[model samples]
Target: MTDLDAETEFLGEWGRFQQQTFFLLCLTVIPNAFTALSIVFVADTPPHRCLVPAHVNLSAAWRNSSIPLEEDSHGGGPRPSRCSRYRLGDIRNFSDGGLLPGVDVNLSTVATEGCVDGWEYDRTTYDSTISSEWNLVCDEGWKKPMSSSVVFCGYLLGALVSGQVADRFGRKIVLVVSIGAHSVFATILAFSSSWTMFCVIYFIVALAHTSRTGSAFVLGTEILSTRVRKIFSTVGGNMFFCVGYMLLPLAAFFIRGWRMLLLALALPSFLLLTLWWCVTESPRWLLSQGRAEEAEAIVRDAAKKNQIEPPAVIFGPSHNECKPERRKAHNICDLLRTRNIRWISLTLWVIWNTLTVAYYALSLNTSNVHGNKYLNCFLSAAVEIPAYILSWIMFRWCSRRRSLFSTLFMGGLFLLLTLLVPANLVHVAVALEMMGKFAVTTAFSIMYAYTVEVYPTVLRNTALGACSMASRIGSIVAPYAIYLRSYSISLPYILIGSLTVLSGLLSLLLPESNGMPLPDTITHMQDFPGCCKKTPYKLTQTEENEPAAEGKCPVVS
Candidate 1:
């Protein structure tokens, strides 16, 4: 749709406060979790744990440092102490002589404490200086990548299950409950005494954590006029990630412990609930559930708030969109019933997942920057703000095909640069990857808005939840990709770029929703394929209730 249509239909009709309030809430909600993805960064170590030249001795040190043991065990027995239990396999005892001729220090014992949660120890952590989480996960015989993959799996599972939970339980209730669940689980994650515990809690917090995502998207989409719907819903959704990426470095820079980091990240879920009191339910949702009276009440209040008078025209008992339907229980399959919706949702899922893969994979590799990692990480993330701005501008100025294609193209092009450049120019490589990140970030932001336009109102949340789940596929695979330096760098780039290109092409297959009334589900979308360019949308027999005026919902703004 043209800007004239956007302004005429959306800008003026939507009372400023209503639009602005939702926008503010969206921006506010994104920062906490988006920033937390970087939590794992503080726990990441460079391959081989690069030893810095700090002018320190290579000699080992006494791990447990019991003053009594020091006094009793040949005090200062002309032997160097073990410096760290980081290499538990290297634990040993020596008498100022070569460790007993045939002794296997590697076999002596597994240190019990101060280790990453993945591995179990037979004894206590012997050192205090280094990140035990890093060392412990690192020494897991090249399984670190696999361990990180668990987070991605958690992301997938969270997206799949939470859609029904949100629909069945109500968004407000889910949000309220998830706040507690997220904080408690995240806090418990800090006390993880074993790798098994860490893995389980990671999934738990991840599932609860996702509650904040799709529901917010649904709310943002529901509260907007059709013209501005794409921008409000999609850009708002993408902004969540942008806000998160920005905060990651702050956490990584200031917070170190995995537990403390999780707690900090989990706190926002609680805070968002308190602020939720200022908001209201999506009357459209209530109306769909056959609760017209309740829906009408909400609409009347919304009109009052916006200073618009509610109309008396009654919608019939047979209305579909924004009218009550005896809503059947929902599941993932419901999202695929319509051709346009199924394809579009699948595409969104694939695109976002691919972008996330490239993002987490390359972004986490920043430890190689070595000095001031916090600075490089933060600067890289800061670059994404422009990505959002660019997406906003392009989405307005260009077709979805052109806009999506260009964004994905740039991301791929830059990722290619990162691949082709010689390793000597490490800074250049990093710059290219940062640029790729920005491009994907821009695309990611745009896609969220794009998905809202594709599905109709009824299946909006379900389709979105499905797509969101798909996007997390990349996240699942990312850790293992960039983690292995021995693997060819070109491989990850090629994979991400190809997936993005495919997604861009997929956008061409979708009907343009520009200037069209927003759809509520697959059925609605199927009802009007061209969206308002060629034909007027006709109400289905059972679907038409009363000849109510358009924009006549009891709620205003």
Candidate 2:
């Protein structure tokens, strides 16, 4: 195969064609923002208490005393019990003589019972959520977290399947199919009559969304030149995701009902179908498959769009050219077949898991923050803008390993700081949480670019998929991590902070790939050096011209 970056050098890094393609790919990520975190609003649990029966003849003051106060879980003082009520029968009997409780009759002896008649929700914040409509609180409270976990489960399945399909079929087809499926299922999810039906459809939506996102990331990176690829991966991809996340809270604020909010989010995805006509397959991918004619045609069109004249032979004869009979088919198993690649893959999986857990744990915890839920969510999403910008700057000048390690360490440190914040200073706690989010968002953005560079093109998507699949283990644990806040306000922070710090230490073991050409084959990865030592392999004259040949070092010096 031709060195794809060198072969396409005539088109320039930021030509008209490259600019247009980058914009369209980034657009696909916006709707996915809504799909990934909309559960924050969809399953929100409003303040609620046991319902008082209308048949009980009692004054307003007497009715108010029917529900007993319980100790607040967060040390905020006594509040109304969510799942229990003082026995109404005892209250009614005590009030038969029109005697008030506490003064005339002792109410301490009264026993409490579960909310048998159902509960009444406080709809000040949300007009209606799945929690209020279906009563997913108390005994059925487990279902809310289960619903969030189901989405991550779908993500795990999508990562496992989409990588293989994209590698086999093509990136364009996978992107098209995944986006269309996500739109259809998300729209269908809005009209669900039962929670069971809703969860099943939501799972499919999550699966399709994950596939669409992975395919878009791989396609964007492959099509752009090495210099532009870093920009596209770090800033271009995640900035749009942040925009969609910010928009979600704004949309949910106006459309407080869950069904309508879902409809508003899903309907706009159909506009993305136009991408099929504008987006082309990755030239790098086509050449790797030995479809030189197709790759050349796309290259010529890009040259024409950029108003540059192409040479007589765009791709010269080279040793890297693909021979179908001689080429061994690559699969997920290939990731673990070698020593260097195996260790790299294992290290990446651990890093990905830690980032996923910390990132989602902070994002989902916005609802439980002390201020207005909408404001908290909007601020959380807004903080990612600067984080991504900082990531792009670091990618341009700093080492990938050092950038990742610094961000993870700082993020963990910020989260740990939350434990020392006084309970009375709610704003201080919120600020620390956002700072943690900012740092993790930066690390998460860097991880995307760094992982793509670590593997060869043949197994890039497959490796990314496998690593993504592993990260779902953390995402699966994230909702429950947030749930831990109910037990002790500090438990979630302790868990997330400790894991994040540990992952940063693990990242030091991987090799640095700054300014290195993307590896095209397993042989290329084998020749590459690790962060700590040099392989000291000899290269042919032709190999000397390759980009990866320039960056084999024993240490930073």
Best candidate, lDDT-wise?
Answer: 2
TM-score of each: 0.75, 0.95
Task: Work out how many backbone clashes candidate 1 has.
Answer: 25
Candidate 1 lDDT over 332-358, as tens digits, reads 786666665566556566677777777
In order, candidate lDDTs are: 0.58, 0.86
After TM-score superposition, what is the CA distance of residue 327 in candidate 2 from its true location, in Å?
A: 2.3
